[model samples]
Target chain A: MQEIPKPTIRRLAVYYRCLERLEQKNVEKVSSKELSKMLKIKDSQVRKDLSYFGTFGRRGVGYNVKELKEKIKEILGLNKQWSVIILGAGNIGKAIARYKQIEKDNFKVVAVFDVDKRKIGTQITPELTVRSLDELDEFVKKNKPEIAVLAVPADAANPLAERLEKLGIKGIICFAPVTLTCSIPVEYVDITVFFKTLVHFISRGIQ
Target chain B: MQEIPKPTIRRLAVYYRCLERLEQKNVEKVSSKELSKMLKIKDSQVRKDLSYFGTFGRRGVGYNVKELKEKIKEILGLNKQWSVIILGAGNIGKAIARYKQIEKDNFKVVAVFDVDKRKIGTQITPELTVRSLDELDEFVKKNKPEIAVLAVPADAANPLAERLEKLGIKGIICFAPVTLTCSIPVEYVDITVFFKTLVHFISRGIQ
Candidate 1:
């Protein structure tokens, strides 16, 4: 199999989102040009990115929006449901647990864990409660959530992540500012980067 | 001046962050190999990325931690203060407005605006208030804030962004699921991407 560039994979996710909006608007078919225009990506670039996964569009009529979206979802492994756990019950953690994981189908929060005794056993949402850190390994073993969202402070991030990975967690979406040194995957996020990157892109606006 | 690649700019920001950590640990220098190992980028890739911004280190000695970090900061223009506004008073909006933008040093939220009458008069922080949407134009004109975090829902995202751009707002970090179609710079953030993309990355783990 040909390895797609990381940027191309990220762009595929963006294209998936665009296709979804198209589906919502009841727009069925779209050419590569339309998709490129909507995303401000080059038309040739779009074709090159999609070519890594088998071809999708008809020559003249373009591509079926629903079909292309589903194909990307399957390629991305989003078609499978993924149970998720939040490793901290901080503000960001609480917010993420509460937000519906609709785009991620099966990827929904199954539990939230924090060290704060006060927050432990408290309800994050009616659907999930803040569990004690002591119960994390045991609960994760039982339920087998494949992913964890690490929202602890930077100081606590590495330790919690090491433990999460030791307990068989496959991936982490980290809100804590620290970069993890784990063998398993870690995606670091900071709310500020969204702004900084925006400014950078603006300073060097699109070609 | 040479135009840097977008990915290189983003990586420079990451290097700035990594160097900040190294500075805290009293680590004075880092080889491209060590930095690449930490970030999982190729050693040559690190050298090439840094070269785009000009020579930063001795070939044998690697980079001075503090000096390299400061250089990246200047290159990315993070050395200055930026007044930011939040365009919504929702949960995510409220949280972003309240969180100190101290790390992005000087990238602080100066005001928050919402169309909800009840929320419009409320105080977000002792330092900030939730002004009504009607007051946005006047306030922006008077204060001249160039950056905004768009936390409004998708329905309100487009129009508010359009209005913001017309008023000369330069950059936006949008949380709404909808994509913005504006002439000025807009950065879209859907928190859900953290998990979905993590899953995607883990599914297609490094080559």
Candidate 2:
């Protein structure tokens, strides 16, 4: 398998999403210029990023919408469904559970776990049922979810992340603001920092 | 004013957040090595990034935690509260309105607007009241929210963003997956793409 840079992978996902819109609008093809204009990126950057995989676009005619969309999906490893388990039923966790993007992106929220007994047994949606953290080890061992989302408070983040790491979980999406150091080779994306940056950019304006 | 790279700005935010944690733990000073270990970044990179602003760290003694934290906050322009508005009052919007990070980061969600009558006039929280899209123009004109968060669907993203642009909103945080093009200069951060990348990195493992 070919290795793709992380930044390139994110651009591929963006391109895939853009193609989805074009496909819905019945647009047949998209040039790098068009894609760049819509995405606010340089056209050369878009073409160069796409060129890493193969020549999916015609020089003069641009890229075939349907073909480009599929190619991006295949490249980003989004062609197959991945099961996701969200830890913590707090505001952030529940927001993610109800987020429409997860379903659109083909990630299935299999279950939600929280330490609060009051939240246990409640339903996020009909598809996702809340369970106690006590069941986490058993559920993870039995179900083997591909992705684990950490939505617990800052105090709980590191310990829970360690627990997820021990469970042999591959990926962790952490919402807590606390910094987590993991030796067990888990990938973590911090949403609090992400949102903070978003707010910072908006307030300070991008340079 | 200096032009700071977007990635650097993001790192500054992360450092600010980390420093906040360190302060709460009563850590008076931190070396770049310690900060890097805590944030999972290279110590050299951390020092280089910090050097862009000024000589923040001493050669041997490292950095003063509280001083470094305050400096980052000042550099990122987070010392003042930023007024924000949510374009959609759906599940995600409501969750953001109730999220504690907004308050922690000193961002105030002044209002939430949606076209759905069922959701309009509903209270997300006591501070944030739901308003109709009909009032979008007037509310923006009157309040002049510095940051506008696009939580609307893909199809509605561009149009709503355009409206926000015309109304003189400075920055936008896009939650929709679609590509957005705006006449007014806007900083677009796709939360969906961020989460998708997190999931991808976790599932595939980051090298």
Candidate 3:
């Protein structure tokens, strides 16, 4: 397989969501131009990115919405269920655990852990309880979650990520504001970056 | 003076943060190579991105960390204070309101509003309280927040954004998992996209 650029990977996920939205609206087919207009992406760029995976759309008929959605789902590994563990019981962690869409999207929140003893044993969701970080070693050995969601503090994120990588975690979805130096894939969900982008545009009088 | 690419804008923010960390550690100077190594960006890419703003640094002496950080901060509009209103009082909204870093970053949570009657009048922080969405019109009229944060449900995001645009909101930082169609700039904080990225990498055995 050809190496896909990271931005293209992100755009593929976006295309999947856009198609999902189209399906919900009872739309059956979409042209690259239509998709690009909806997403503000270039039509040629959309075609080029999708071609990295495989051709789907016909010459004039465009692509079948459901078919393309499912194909991108498989390409993104969203077709299979993924077991996930949340590493904080803070607002972000609890919110993610309580997010119904996660289960719907084939990602399961198998467990939640926190360093706060006061939060330990507390129920985040009826199906999930916050566990002590001290129990992480035993728990990981037993349940073996594939992904770890880091919602911890900036200072703690790096060391925790190192441990999670050592424990064989495949990837991390980090909500912390720090840079992680783990060998495993770390997706930093730095909300402030979005804020910075907003300020930059606002200051530039773009709006 | 030039039209900076959106990706470069985001990178400027990243460079500012990385430099801030260095300043905290009393690091006085850094080369493009050192910054790129810390950020996982290409050295030439760093120099090119920074050059879009202005030329800095002397030959073989590296860039003064404090001077470069301040310059990027000014370029990104982080030097000026911004008034912000969050439109949802749910977990994400509350977390963002309660975040102490916002004030540090020069963005103030001037107000928070929600559609839920039960949540209104609740204190999210010692300084901020949740107001009814019904009061959004008056609040925007009276206070004139430059930015509106959309943390509401996906379905509610678009219409609310339309209302905000009409109310003279400069820009938006949206946390809802939906495509917002507004005349103003919208910065989307789609956490699920990050999840999709992680799953893609994990499934591809990239780590």
Candidate 4:
């Protein structure tokens, strides 16, 4: 398979959500033009992105909304349940644990970890408990969660990320403001970057 | 100025951050190759992104780390302070309001708004309070925030976004899972999309 562009992956997810919404609205079919109009991107861009997985939509008739949605869901690995452990019990980590969308998308938070002894025994959700960072080795040995969320402070992130890699974690979702030097695939949930992007547009006087 | 690719904007922010880290290490100069190696991107890509601003660095000596960092900060509009209002008092909203990095980046949360009566009149930080959504008009008139954060649920996002645009909000940072259809510039903080991106890599066996 050819290497896909990173931006295309992001857009594919957006297209999946667009298709999901169209499906919700009982819209049976959607053209690339229609999807493009809704998303404010070029129609050709839409066709090109979907073409990545294989040409699905008919040239004239367009794509079947539910089929396209399901295909993208499977492509994104959302069809399978993913076990996740968060590395912090701070405000952001707790919010993520409580975020209803993660479970709906099949990424379940199986555990929350923190270095703070005061927060170690607390409950994030009824089913999930905050555990000590020291206990991570024991938990990973048994449960083997594939993803680790780095919601710790910047100073703590790199060391914990190193520990997670040693524990056989495959991927990471980082919320730290600082960048991690980990070798594994790390996705950032940097809200400040979004703010900077927004302000970049604002300063440029673009709507 | 030429139209910049959205990905370029995002990468510029990343480069800005990388430069900040280099500057902290007291590294006085950096080559595009060195930066690309650190960020795991092509050297030409880094040069192309920096070229969007202007010709900044010498041919052989590379870029002065401090100067390059400062220039990117100015280009990203991070040098100026931005007043912001968040439109939800939920866990995500509270997390964002309490996010120390936003204030560090000069984006100040002037107020938080919510429809929940129980959350209204509450303090998020001692300097900021959660106000009723009904009071948005009066507050906007009195203290015009340049940016509004849509941290509300999917169902409530669009209407509140429309209202924010009407009140002259320049840009938005959205946390809702749904795609917002507002006219103004909206940057998404979609954590699920990041998760999906990570899983796509994991499924593809990318490191």
Candidate 5:
């Protein structure tokens, strides 16, 4: 099996979001040109990116919005339920757990964990509670959650990440400042870096 | 001036992050090749990206860590203070206002706004208060905030964004699902899409 480029995967994620919007607006068909214009990418680039995944569309008609949305979701693994857990119940962690969008994308926060004894057993969201950190390995071993949102503080991040990896977590949405050295993939959302990047965009006068 | 490509800007953001970490650890100098490997980018890409900005180093010495960090910060506009406002006092908005990282980047949240009457006049953070949506225009016009964080719901996002642009906002860090069509640049952090992208990365066998 050939590996898809990361940029294409990122763009596919963007395309999926666009398609979902189109579906919500009751839009059925979307041409590559239209998508390109909306995404600010060249029309050819849009077509090429789409082609990398598979064929979608026929003759004069463009992509069917609902079908394309499903295809992208399936390609991105959103078609199946992904049991997820939050590694902290702090401000950012709780915010992510409370975020409605996570649940909408079929990524379920099965539980949240915190080292604070006071936080343990407290409900972070109605469906999820902050469990003790001690229970994490056993819980993950039993539940086989495919992903975890690592929202612990910087000092705790690396150690917790190692523990999670040793416990066989497949992916991590890390909010902490620390970097993890695990075979499992980690998607970092370093707020300082992201905000600084935003500053850079505004500074460079925007492309 | 030649326009720097966005991927370079994004990588510059990554480099800035790496440099900050290096500075924290008291590292004084770093070669482009070393920085490139640390960032998972090619060595030439690092040099080329930095060259897009300006000259940085001498023959054999490589980049001076503090000087390079400051240069990147200046290039990214972190040297100057940027007045910012939050468009919603919702969970995400308040979390962003209190993030502490934003302040570290020299982006100040001057105020927070919401359509809800109950939320208006309430303290959002130690420095910011929730204001009425109607007050946003006059406030922005008076304050000249360069950036706005759009944390509003999908339905309200478009209108509020237009209002913010009309009030002369230079950039937006939009969390809403809705896309804004303002001439000023917009950086999106659509959680649903981002999480799904993370899912795709893991699903694709973790590059």
Candidate 6:
């Protein structure tokens, strides 16, 4: 298996979105040039990025829109359904559960967990029922969710992350701005930190 | 002014966080190799990234922790304060308003806006007041805010974006997942679409 760079993975997502737009227009095929223009990126860079995987585009003609979309999806590991569990069931958690895009594919929100009794019995969405934090191990053991979104407060983040690690969760999308220490592999994406940094940048006016 | 790549900007954020950690530990200086090891990135890459602006590291010694951090912050435009406004006072909007990090620097969340009359007079935080959507133009003009965070639902995204553009807001960080068509210069970072793409790839097992 070839290793995909993280930046490249993000670009693959952008490319997938572009293909979706192309397909919606009933466009049969697209060239790297066309995609670059649509995405406001350089054509050669697009071609080079795609080439890192395989020759999805033909030299003379172009790429088949549907085929290219499917290939990029496959490359990004979006080919199958991935069951997801949301921990915390707080505002952020519920917001993610209600997020429309996460509902597509097999990326179903199987369950939500919170220690708060007021939230435990509540339902975030029709598909996601709130459960106790105690049930997390059992839930992961039974449901085998591939992703766990950590939406708990900053104080609870590290402990919950450790628990998720113990439960053998694959990937984690953390909302809290806490450094998670885990033995098991997990992708940590701190949205709060990401935005805060952006705000800092804009405040400074670097360029 | 040299163009700073987007990836480098993101990494600068990561480096900032790392520097905060170093400062907490009372670390005086850090070499590129040590920083790279701490970040799990290549040493040469770290050196190259810093060298983009100018040589910040000494040949043999290392970078001055405090000085290097300040330089990176200035380069990323974190020197000044930026007043930010959220367009919708919903769940996501309130979340952004309540986010702790945004309050640290000059990135103050001065006001929130909603269409609901009951919500209009509400306070999101001690610092932020929920105003009516009709007040956007006047409020923006009076405050001269540099950045706007669009936390309105997907349906209201584009229209609100246009209004923000008309109001001459500099940058936008949209939480909604709608495609934006803007005449003015705006920077958008869509959280929903970004996470969905992550789920897409994880499910596909592309890596």
Best candidate, TM-score-wise? 3
lDDT of 2 at B184: 45
lDDT of 3 by residue, B1-207 (tens): 987878898888888888988999999989998888888888999999988867786768889999999988988889878999999998888888877767788899999999898999999999988999998999999999999999899889999999999999999998888777787988887778888988999988884
> Candidate 5 residues B94-119, lDDT tens each?
88888886687787889898888889
lDDT of 1 by residue, A86-153 (tens): 98887778777867644245677889999999999999788898989999889989999988888887
Per-residue lDDT for B68-163 in model 4, tens only? 889889888899899999899998999999998889789888999999999999988888788999999999988989999899888888888888
TM-score-based ranking: 3, 4, 2, 5, 1, 6
Candidate 2 residue lDDT tens string, B85-194: 99898877787788877777888888899999999878788776788999989998998888788888878999898888889887777777766677543444565665
TM-score of each: 0.92, 0.93, 0.96, 0.95, 0.93, 0.81
The per-residue C-alpha lDDT of model 5 at residue A63 equals 92
Question: What local lDDT does model 3 show for residue A207?
Answer: 43
C-alpha positional error of residue A180 in candidate 2 after TM-score superposition, expressed in Å: 2.6
Write down the lDDT that model 6 would get: 0.74
As a TM-score, model 6 comes out at 0.81
lDDT per residue for candidate 2 within A33-114, as digits (tens), equals 9999888879999999989878978888999999989877766668778788999998778988988778788888899999
Model 2 clash pairs are: A171-B202
TM-score of the A-chain for all models: 0.91, 0.90, 0.96, 0.95, 0.92, 0.90
What is the two-chain DockQ of model 2? 0.50
Return the clash pairs for model 1, or none: A81-A106, A82-A106
lDDT per prediction?
A: 0.80, 0.80, 0.88, 0.87, 0.82, 0.74
The alpha-carbon lDDT assigned to residue A35 of candidate 5 equals 91
**Model 1 misplaced regions, further than 4 Å:** A101-104, A201-207, B101-104, B204-207
Best-fitting candidate, measured by lDDT? Answer: 3
Candidate DockQ values, in order, are: 0.51, 0.50, 0.72, 0.73, 0.59, 0.30
lDDT of 2 at B21: 84
Q: Quick one: how many clashes does candidate 5 have?
A: 0
Q: List fnat per candidate, in order.
A: 0.40, 0.41, 0.71, 0.80, 0.54, 0.17
Worst 10 contiguous positions by lDDT, candidate 4 chain A = A1-10
TM-score of chain B of each: 0.91, 0.92, 0.97, 0.94, 0.92, 0.89
